[model samples]
Target: MARPRKPLLSRDRIVTTALALIDEEGLAALSTRRLAAELGVSGPSLYNHFATKEAILDAAADTVVGRVDLSMFRDGRDWRGALLAWGRSYRAALTEHPRLVPYLAVGPGLRPAGLRMADAVFGGMVEAGWPPAQATRIGALMRYFVTGSALGSFAAGFVGDAAAYDPADYPHLGQAHLLARHREQVDEGAFETGLRALVDGLALQYAELGAGKDDAQGGAKGAAAE
Candidate 1:
C-alpha cells in the first residue's frame, strides 16, 4: 500500500480528545494509554505532539476557556450589559465540563487562550472607565465566582438520602430534600443572583470613580481661579 498524504493525528485532535476524556470521566481518567486507545494510535505518538500529560491537559482546559464569547466587550457596549452577557457565556462553558474546574481555577498558566480571555475582560473593564486596579480585581472576582459555581451542584449535595433532613434535628430542612429534584432551577438561580450582585456592587464603585474625578477637577479649577 502507498503511504497516505495526511497524518492521522494533529494537535487539535489531541486537544479535543483529551477534553472529551476529561469531560466524560474526569481529570483522573486521562492517561497516555487510555487516550491512545481512544485515539487509535500508539502511546508514543501522543508524545510527538505534547511533551507530557499535564501539557495536554492544559491545552484541553484552555480549549474550554476559549469557548467564552467576548463580542460584548467590543466598542459601543456598556460594561454592565457586557458583564451580564459574558457571565452567562462563561458559566455555560464551565458548567458543561464541571470536572475541569480545578484545572482552570489554577489560573491561566501558559495557556494562550486562557490568557486572551483574561486580557479581554481586563482590557474591556479598563476601557470602560474602571481604574486599572479595580479592573484586575473584577477579572479575579468573576473567575472565583464562575469556577466556584461549576465545582459542584449545591442541590445534589442533599440527594440520595431525603430522610437525612429529619423534622426534629433539621426542621428548617423540611423542604430541603426536594432540592435535588430542582437542581437546575436552584443552581441557575444562585449563579444569576451572585453574578448580578457582583455587577451591581461594581457599578456603584464605577459611579464613585467618576464622581471623585469630577470633584478633583472642580477643586483644581477653583484653585486656579484664586
Candidate 2:
C-alpha cells in the first residue's frame, strides 16, 4: 500500500490534536505518545514538530488565546469600548477552558497569538492617550483579573448548609448562609462591578492627564507672551 500522497504531520495538526486531548482529558492526560497515537503517527514523529511537551502545551494555550476577538482594537475604533469588549471576550474564552487557565497563566507568551494579543492591548491603550508605562500595567491588570475570575467558582464553593454556620459561634452569619443560593448572580455582579470600576478609573486618569497637559500649555503660552 502507498504511504500517502500528502504529508501526514504538521505543527498545526499536532497543536490541534493536543488541544483536543487536553480539553477532553485535561492536561495530565496529554503526552507525546498519546498524541502520536491519536494522530496515527509514531512518538518520534511528534518530536519533528514539537521539541518537548512544554512546547506542545504552549501551542495549545496559544490556540485558546487565538479565539479571543481583538477586532475591537482596529483602526478608527474607540479604545475604551474596544477594551471592554476585549475583556468580555477574554473572560468568555477562559471560562470555556477553565482547566487550561493555569497553563496559560504560566506559559511563555512568545507564541504568535499570545504576542499579538499583548501588542494589540498595549498599543490600543497607548493610542487612546495612555502612557506606555500605564498601558503595559493595565494590560497586565486585565490579564490578572480575567485569569483570576476563571479560577473561581463562587456558587459551587459557597457554604450552602445552614448548619455549617453556627449562630452561637458566628452572630453575624444569619444571612451569610443564603449566599450560595445567589452564587451565579453574585459572582457575575461582582465581576461586572469590578470591571466597570477598573475601566472608569482609567478613564478618570486619562481625563486628569489631559487637563494637566492643557493647564501646562496655557501657563507656557502666558509666560511666552509676557
Candidate 3:
C-alpha cells in the first residue's frame, strides 16, 4: 500500500473534534467509536494519539482553558486588576463549556496548558505580595466559585410561577417569578458582583498585611532607639 498523501490524525485535530462532539451532544455523547467515526478513521487510530477516552477529555478540557485571556498577568498589571480580568475570562470560558466544568474541576490539571494556567495564577498572586499559602487558597477559591456558578441555574431553579408560591406562606418570593425572565442578565450580574466582592476582600487582606508589616518594622525601630 502507498503512503497516504495527507496526515490522518493529529493531537489538535482529535481534541478539537472531541470538543465539538461535547459541545453539540454533551459529554456523554463522546466515545472513541463516535469520535473515530467523526474523524473518518478507525477507532484504534485514536489510541495512537490518546491513551484512553479520559485522556482525550482532559485534552479537550485544557483546550477550553487555553481560550481564557491570561495576558493581563504578563504586563505588570496590578494584582487585583489582573485577577479580576483572569477571573472573568476563566468564568466566560467555562460558562461556554458548562457541561465540562464538573470534569475540569476535579482533575489534577496534568496537561501542559492547564498547568501553565495554574502557574500563571499562582505566580501572579505571589508576585502581588500574597503569601504562597494564601495564593494557593485564593486560586482554589476562584475555581470553586466559578465552577459552582457554571453548574448552577439560578433562574431555572427559581419558582417562576406565581401559583407555586402562595403570598401568605412566602411573602418575599411573590415577585420571584420575575427572576426567571431575566436569567442571563441576573446571572451575569450576580457573577460580576461576587467577583468584585472577592477581589476587594483579597485587596483588603493584602492591605492589612502591609499595615502589620509596617507596625512590626516601627516596633523594631523603637526597640533599637531604646
**Candidate topping TM-score:** 1
What is the C-alpha lDDT profile of model 2 across 32-116, one tens digit per residue?
Answer: 8999999999999899878999899888888889999999998567877887889889988887787788888863368899899
What does candidate 2 score on TM? 0.85
Residue 50 C-alpha lDDT in model 3: 94
Q: List where candidate 1 sits over 4 angstroms from the true fold.
A: 4-6
Q: Write the per-residue lDDT of candidate 1 for residues 82-142, one digit (tens) a residue.
A: 9999999998999999999999999999899899898999999999999899999999999
Please estimate how well model 3 matches the true structure, expressed as its whole-model Cα lDDT.
Answer: 0.89
Least accurate 10 contiguous residues by lDDT in model 2 = 151-160
List the RMSD of every prediction in angstroms.
Answer: 1.5, 2.7, 2.2
Candidate 3 per-residue lDDT over residues 33-66, each given as its tens digit: 9999999999999999899999999889988988
Model 3, C-alpha of 49: deviation from truth (Å): 1.3
lDDT of 2 at 190: 77
- Ranked by lDDT, the better of candidates 2 and 3 is 3
Global lDDT of each model? Answer: 0.92, 0.86, 0.89
Candidate 2 Cα lDDT to native: 0.86
Report lDDT (Cα) of residue 186, candidate 3. 89
